[model samples]
Target chain A: MRNLLKILYTYHFLLMFIALEVISIIMLVQNNRYHSASYAVKAKAVSGSIYSTVSDFKEYLSLKEANKALAHENAILRNYLKSNYGTFDTTKISVNDSIYKQHYRFQDAKVVNNTVNKQYNYITLNKGTKHGIKPDMAVIGPQGIVGLINGVSENFSNVLPLLNVDFRVSARLKKNNYLGSVTWEGKDFEYCTLKDIPQHVQVNKGDTVITTGYTGSFPEGIMIGTVSSSKLKDGNFLSIEVKISTVFKTLSYVSVIEDLTKEEVTKLKTETEK
Target chain B: MIGEYIKIALRFFFLVVLQLLVLNNVQWSGYLNPYLYVLFILLLPFETPNWLLIILSFLLGFTIDSFSNTWGMHSAACVLTGFIRPYFLKIISPRDGYDSATRPIIRDFGLEWVIKYSLILIFIHHFALFYIEVFKFSLFFHTFLRVVLSTLFTFTLVIISHFIIYKR
Candidate 1:
């Protein structure tokens, strides 16, 4: 027993190294699962505040660009207003119309921190649980879809952006409605891969791709990207390259979408699975 | 002795800030990520206790991970670098051994010695970091390419930083 103690004393430095490495590996594995709430909450709060401060300074440099984008969005929204069109019929629709129940609500948030080069990139937003942001909600930029909220704290949240290799979303070609899955290849921030579409489908360059809404995370028909190119893969499916619509580097303001019927859908799905 | 400790503490804070605020935002390409934070571990006093070195490296890495959301990749790499530092120092020591009063900086050690010392440790750190990041061997070649490119980039930045920080 004394000899064993001597051995341990001699190799204490190596033992300590191994112990620390083991702890780090455990944290890494746990972090990949994307469900470590305590760490996420604490880390997000600290990093989020620092990033928000830096972003506050950066906000000035990009004010002109942000104003331009907001102005464009305002113009598009104005065209959808009720006052834009003259009423031809006298019949008035009731406020609680059965055909038009609200299915989704959007909350505006500014991006405080973002990274596009990593294999599992995450974006931090200024709004969080206080603003009703929750896990699994869809985040969309002005140009197109952004990502999904994977972690949330009191006043900040983390987004698993489209650039992450682990991020997958259901997308369909607008021309033929052919469905496929969109995934990042961990190479270019501007491009992602769309798979599972059969080679027989007619795929043309610049064909629009949008969300399928089959998962209920995103509403149907939200723009994802446009097909850049397509190639035959394994003689069965076509591996198509998509140019993502939202330029993540310049991404500033985004809207987090909350689906009101999501709980019901999830309940039904769980029951059906059983 | 207390002044030396204070200097080390100030350097730790300074390097972390430089890494998070400036270097982290500078994404030249998908392949080049210059992690200058490891310089903190590289510049520690030669006589720093082995256990303390490991712990400090782990803390530095964890702090960066918390901000970047990399979890433990940086921590693991930093710990390994710290573990191997003493051995590397022994291998590349001067004829009369290191002066007790001197720290591991380019001004104290010649340019070639400093470069050689940092090259091996930085390569190991970047290799472990990028590989642990992907956490798979399927992209072995791709990750290796990234490690090599990033190591070169980081080495250049570290050398430039030495001249800037330890100006003659």
Candidate 2:
């Protein structure tokens, strides 16, 4: 055994490379099983602690802005209640118009350590297992979708930001319903590209882009961005350039949207991937 | 002596954090993500053991892996780099070489040797990393493109970092 090992080592780095290949194969095979079980254990404790700490950090930073946003949102809700008061015919005449029917959950979170400059930028959030955050959960800001959670750390999770080249969010024109894939070119934080839209879709320079409701993260009709420009790709498909509204680098606060059906949908998707 | 070892360890920790937290995040094009923190290993004292060097490289890469969630890429690259460092030292060995006392630097290894040394190591590290991250060889075009682009970016950044940190 010693002599055989020596002979292999005499092949110098070739032996090392072969060893690595074997390890890589083994890891690929065992990754899913290992990640699920171990993630359950480790993610709960570590991610939870990190999430709380980072949440504390973020609440401080967003105190003023968050208060303003809340006040504005409150004002809008109150005004909405006033306008539709006649629609309610209850004995008490309560002002309730579709408030209970809103389909979006706004779970506040903190960005722990986010990167917008990477071709594969990932943002770590302070909401995870404890906060009901899960992988593939839709993350958004006041502007639009920040990205989806790729890995969860129990109380904390990492988001694959739209600034990352890996992100491909399905979006459509609000007025016309022309759908396309929105992806970051891994360059500018202020811009992204929307591709595969038919050139005949009649795109305007400032038409609203919103989620198409094809995936689990965001509901259909959630705002993504406005069309910055449009061009003919291969002189057929419409290639629209979009300017993302979120400031990922300077971003501090976010909302992790936990769709009620996310768990079942993700479980099915994960099984399919395996 | 204990204090010195602790300081060295702390510096290694600092380099890795800065690499992932700051430098890895700074992407100009989708093409470039520089790995300059490995310079800590490159600049180590010449008497460092071969086995320890390999282990250090593995640890360095593993840390990066844990953060990025990409399996063994950084480890493979760092290990390959560690394996090649000694050979590089031999290739550029001078009559009164700095292998025993002097460190690998522009001042010690001279301008030409330093450039040659850094370029070779950067290519080796980036090749292993990009190729490993690109597990499926089926995507030949994409893997090839990344290898070329990342190597160029890594080479430029590593050289610039060396000049700034260890200027002759």
Candidate 3:
């Protein structure tokens, strides 16, 4: 026992080093796999407030650009208004519309923090649980899909952006309805790779890709990006490169999508799997 | 002694703020992430106890991790850096050995010694950091490129900061 105590005293520095590293690694694994809501919640409140204050100053610098993007979106929305189009058939036909209920609700939020360079990137928004934002909700920019909420605090939330390596979403080609999965290769911010599309399916440059709604986080038909190129891989699957539509660097504002039927869909899915 | 401690504490605060507010936001390119916060660990007094060094390094890394949402990558790397730092210092000591009361700074040691010291430590820190971040061996060459590029970027910043801070 005396010899053992002597040995520990001599190697105490190394033991302390190992202990600290082990703790850090444990935190890393927990943060990555389970998203460690308890720890992140407190950290988010402190960091989120700092980022929001800094972003408030930055918001003014990008006001001109934000105004232009908002104006363009407003014009597009105006074109869809019922007053702009006339009905060719005036006959009143009452269809069974009660079956169609709202499946998604949107809340506008300002991006207080965003990073695209890292292998695993995250975005922070000004709105959080206080504003009804929750984990697993989808976030979309003016042009296309952004990401999904992974962590939330009282007045802030973190988004696992599509640029991250772990982010994968079900998407389909708009031209032929062929399904594939979109994943970032950690190479470029403006592009992601689409895999699992069979080689037999026709693909071409500039073909549009949209969400398939299979994940239930995002609704159907939201734009992801257009195919920049496609190649045959291993004689079975076509590895296609897609140029993402949303400009992540200049992202200022976004909409958080709350899928109202998510609980019902998830419950049904679990039952089916079981 | 108290004054020296106060200075170290101030440097810790300054470096953290600079890292989170300025360096973290600097989008030079996807590959050039210069982590200037490690400078805090690099510039510590040689007389600092080993256990205190490791704990301070962990705290510095954990603070950065909390703000950046990187969790534990930085803390792990910083602890390793701190663990190996004394050995590295011993290896690179001058023919006569280090002065008793001198801190590791550009003013105390010449530019060449400081560069040689920081370059090796920074490379190791970036190497450990990027690999822990990717956490895979498949993209070996890709992560290697990032490590090299980031080390060079960080080295240049450290040298520039030395001149900026120590200029009389």
Candidate 4:
């Protein structure tokens, strides 16, 4: 025992170093796998709120450019509303059911930490608990749906940005409504992969992709990317290549979609699992 | 001595603040971010023990991680640098060794050795940082390119800052 103690003390630093590194690796894997599963709704809201504030602070310097972006988005949203729901009474908000149908509200955030070059890209935000932001809220930008909120603190939050290898967004063809998983390849900032797409779907370069509305985090029709290239995988699946339109290295603003019906949906999911 | 202590402490806080607040946001390329803050770790008193140095590195990295929203990139790099520092010092020891050396000034070791020592550790630290950050070895070519580019940038920054401040 004395000999063992002597050896341990002699290499105590190495042992501690190894132990901490192992713990760090474990934490990294666990955080990646179970961020949403473990923390779920409440934690994400806090993170979303943090990023929102951070983005606001960062955008203060680029107010003119941001105003232009806001103006452009406003014009697009107005045109969309005019074409889709012209003269409809939006104030006649339905109590229970319509909330689920449009269960989300969008708020803007900025990238405090963004890395397109990494296998796992994370973005930190400056908004937090005071902002009413929560976990599992879908984050979006002018180009398309960004990613999900992951970590949160009292004053800040981290996003598992779409550029991460671990991210697999459920995307579909805007032209024909075919669905697949859109993932990153960790090489470039502007590109991603659309896998599990069945062959014979008539895919081509420049075909638009959008979200499938299956995850209530985002409403249907949020733009994902355009199919920049594609190849046949085996005989049935299409290995479609997508180029995301969001400019992340210079990304300044994002909107966090607050899901109103998240609790009920989560409760239903838990009950079904049980 | 008291004044010197005050100076180091203030510089430490300032460098950390600059690292988290300003340098963290500067995305020069997909592969590069400048870190002049590790100069602090590199410039610490030569006789500080292994455990304390490692712990300090861990703290510095952890604080940076908190600000930048990472798990352990900087912390891991800093600890790695601390661990290897003693061996590097031993290899580069002068005729008289560490006792007579009062500072890590360039004049003491000449510009070439100083630059070489700093670059070696900086390369190890930053390479480990980016490699672990990308988290897999699959994109070997791409990651290697980034490591080289970022190391050059960081080394330039370190050398420039030291020349200006320490005046050796």
Candidate whose lDDT is highest: 3
lDDT of each: 0.89, 0.70, 0.91, 0.74
DockQ for each model: 0.80, 0.26, 0.80, 0.39
Ranking the candidates on TM-score from highest down gives: 3, 1, 4, 2
Per-residue lDDT over A1-274 for candidate 4, one digit per residue giving the tens place of the 0 to 100 score: 9999999999978886776566556545555552743332244354345445555677787788768877998988888663576454656545434546765777776565566655666776665556766766788888787888766666656677788877777888988888888888887888888898888789888999998877648778988888898899888899988889787766667888887777898899999999
lDDT of 2 by residue, A167-223 (tens): 788888889888788987644678999999987888888888889878656877777
DockQ: which is higher, 2 or 4?
A: 4
After superposition of all CA atoms, the RMSD between model 2 and the true structure is 5.8
- For TM-score, the strongest prediction is 3
Superposed by TM-score, candidate 2 places the C-alpha of residue B74 at a distance from the truth, in angstroms, of: 2.5
- Cand. 1 TM to true fold: 0.94
List where candidate 1 sits over 4 angstroms from the true fold: A86-99, A270-274
Q: Which lDDT tens digits does candidate 4 get at residues B1-168?
A: 688768777877888877765676666657777777888788877877778877777777766654454566677778888788888899987878877446666866778877888898888888888888788788888888888887888889888887888774
Model 2: CA > 4 A from native: A1-3, A21-102, A185-188, A233-236, A261-274, B1-8, B20-34, B96-99, B105-116, B123-168
In model 4, where do residues sit more than 4 Å from their true spots? A1-5, A32-57, A81-103, A108-117, A124-131, A152-157, A233-236, A260-274, B1-4
Docking quality class, candidate 2: acceptable
Chain A of candidate 1 gets a TM-score of 0.92
**TM-score per model (chain B):** 0.95, 0.86, 0.96, 0.92
C-alpha TM-score for every candidate = 0.94, 0.73, 0.95, 0.84
Pitting candidate 2 against candidate 4, the one with the higher lDDT is 4
Strongest candidate by DockQ: 3
Candidate numbers sorted by lDDT from highest down: 3, 1, 4, 2
Q: Candidate 2 residues B138-159, lDDT tens each?
A: 6567656666777777667767
Estimate candidate 4's alpha-carbon lDDT, on a 0 to 1 scale: 0.74
